[model samples]
Target: MQYYKKDKDKLVCLLCSYYCKLKTNQIGICGVNKNTGDKIECLVYGHISALNIDPIEKKPLYHFLPKSKSLSLGTVGCNFKCPFCQNYGISQEKNIDKSKYYSPKDIVNIALQYNCDSISYTYNEPTIFYPYAKDIAIEAKKHGIKNVYVSNGFESKEVIDDMVGIIDAVNIDLKCFNDKYYKKELGGNLNQVLENLKHFKKNGIWLEITTLIVPTKNDTYEELEKIAKFIKDELDIYTPWHLSSFHPDYKDLDLPRTSLETLKMAKKIGEDNGLKYVYIGNVPYENSTFCPNCNEVIIKRNRFEVLQNSIKNQHCPKCLYKIQGVYPKMKTIRKTGFAGSFYPQEKEEILKYIDEFNKQITINGSFDTRAMIVPHAGYVYSGFTANIAYNICKDKKPKRVIVIGPSHSMYYEGASIALYDEYETPFGNINIDKEYSNNLKDKYNFLSFDDNMHLEHSTETQAPFIKHYFANTQIVEIVYGKMPFEDLSSLIDEVLEDKENLLLISTDLSHFYTQEEANKLDNICLNAIEKKDMSLFDNGCEACGKLGVKALIYSAIKKDMKTKVLHYCTSFNKTKDASKVVGYTSALIGY
Candidate 1:
């Protein structure tokens, strides 16, 4: 099976929103999906893990048909292994048998017998079984059968375009507004999912949203408000916002279920945020749809059953209020946070960083060069300019690698040695020499833990590209704030003398200054490094990780290293206004 476009030889699987790019034969984040050959085929294609005849309203799509029946089908594998997975048996089951290949024509004919209004590709990520679903959709459409998708909404724009016209309605699960929930619980990017929702709207599809309030996981009042505001502003106020109560399952079995009070509060948040058609699900409550204009019960419902509908030609029967979700303007333009349409600058900046990285390869110190200095902000804010020096640190192969970065979470003090044996990136995981780091920690004052390392990305992000080029590598991560530069450097020198070692120092330049101010001040620091003079650095150099850079500079000078500037960037390039900028640069030091 093949999926994912190549990211510098490492393949990214676009079968699901996780879009995991495998290294060699490794599977995606979903575990079962893989990109092994020429085309990205779902390994479980036609391998229907579960099948059912469900009510159209079970999909919680109130706008389509009040109470229609649909044939719902699902296959194994999901883009994310969410802790509160409702259908973990089929979603997580790894065994694949093609016995479920009921053929596209067969599926369509069966659905027709039951007079199902639609055939839904749902349950365990429809995108994972794209090949089967696409085939089934083609046959179903020929028979005048509609198709629907219940997805996590984390899709690449390219993937969505390929299936544009075939999809009729989609109910995307908007997990949370915060990135931490996405990174920690969902194992995906929140912004990427938000992008898919926008793409659905742009490409023409019926879109509704659902958010399962998993107690503390994503049911906070702040989170609820953010989500409501996002849907109202970004996807449109007329977009139906469904807040479903959650009962613990899967890995979160110990957690308590979300209270009905919480769901009610969340609905209030959505209504207060200007969402016209807010509804609650998964609890015993009124399912009537209220009109934003007259506050009248426009559409009455009982459980997943609709009782009486007051909408006439899609307008409120009483007030004749037309909503913006479809064609009529809803008096509001969606302002979806990062959920909003990507400001092209975000993508351009990342590409700019890659080009600058290639440029870094153009100018260099050499094979024996071992020291480095870099930045640790997002690709938009610092990446374009951060790869200048890191790209030049190519020495064929290194026996070991040491990456030092600053502690940003504020919980840990001084420095901490990573505990995980491997670190990952778009490229792959770099196996860490635990024994080496453990021994080194015994030789220093650093604390070591896996949890702390997981919370930090500065050191982790730098390891992959380095490992990609340099094989037979073992990595060590050091997260420090203010440690003895000379002392740290001395320990590094001792390690290098006995083994082939490479150093990676991550620290952005100025903090929140304008591009002009950052350039003026950061230039002084860059020039000082070019001169190999640590004393030239002023005290006002406001890099959040200044201590890390200062230590690298001191160590590089002590080791008699040479320098080169690879790239530079400021957040002004990422944000609409260039008034405030965060500076980042890539520099190299080698003997």
Candidate 2:
């Protein structure tokens, strides 16, 4: 609410550190706040650019509101100019679209509609639109909803003072400890952010800190030690620190990604300095909470979901030591969405269907199946074909399976990896190989935990089959939207280096057509895969996962692996309706 003072026909704005004195029709450094005649007005007061329901852990807040969802909202402009900003498309741009306007009442209503426990101001700099967020926070408190700020921690004293009673928690980005990097690379002052850290803790707000550790920029052991020391000495040692991996994005495309070893080193340093809790973000790791006294695992985490927790009533069950963070009062379960919709949900019926399909599969001499290419559709049409390939691979007794498919619902840049601890099926939950999944993401900048992977049928459809055959083996699911063929092939080769790892590619050949037309189109794709011919992909293959198939073929040819076609069929076989049908096929790749 602190705005302007008129002095000799000029307006002086004191909202942030950059107290700009503006003439008529002049804007501040934030680009969204401007002076109009007598007062400073925010151009994006009621406008919203992005909104969604996100897990509180995804905001990297480990110490506050664990295992809950928040209604997140963001406007258009930002004050700082960080080159490696992830949300630069909306944060750095000044083109405001007024069509998507939501008042304070509307925001609180949307939060209640989504069953969210809190409202988060994130994605862009929340300080720029502080007026709008303040109103929403006040209204949300009336409805028993908390307010959070995912900010850069560069606010002025007036702003933090105003948020004393309203803002319940904050996850601030302590980008780096070097003043030169903040001045030259981020257009910010390091001292200001450090001062805000002490202010936030002094005001008794739940404070958590995050640092995006870029590779050669701020990932040195010495620099990391200073950051850890400051948090332990200046702020309380109980403050949770989140060390996130940086992917090359926006204006910094040539920089290398942060490695897993670096994150591990930072975590060790934070612990050595007496910090209670430290977590690695963006890439998966053993990111769980432990009791500081007894070293017992209090809470188990797999990406954004909390798998298992032993913290009872905010105290460790083993040692009876008190834990620092908030714990959920009730148990939570992640349900299966594709069970009743795509196939049978009953266990006996599902086992009967798999048994019937297995009876039709003819497995010859034991083939060491390292990888497989299968189809994903309704069971009546594609189940028999998929069963043939799964039967062959099941003989190998692989310890872990990696499933890759194409995305149909959302568009993302790289491949999306599933972050859930266990995938649900009619039989039971299948354990996920979290260590291998984290290594893949840490080694390649093109892999991330995208929410779209949760809604994708291409990967989820294969869960029941894998669970039925490889009951004890772990699984890793990946979905690609748009990625380079060579990049995926490279990742495949890396994964296949371990002979115990099995790769499965899911796709359906040729959409709706006559039986004759379906076979003609399906045969071309099958022949190309069989012959290891990359050029055959250009001959109208019509496979929905042509990119993944091509990548599999390319990697197989490079590794000198053999390909075998197990079976091929169509939906016409089940319905006896030849007018419109979909093609399905199965194949295997091994030594």
Q: Candidate 2 on 511-536: residue-level lDDT in tens?
A: 88899999999899999999998888
The TM-scores, one per candidate, come to 0.53, 0.55
The prediction achieving the highest TM-score against the true structure is 2
Q: lDDT of candidate 1? A: 0.72
| Worst 10-residue lDDT window, candidate 2 | 326-335
Best by lDDT: 2
lDDT of each: 0.72, 0.86
Tell how far residue 401 is off in model 1, in angstroms: 73
What are the RMSDs of all candidates, in order?
A: 21.9, 20.9
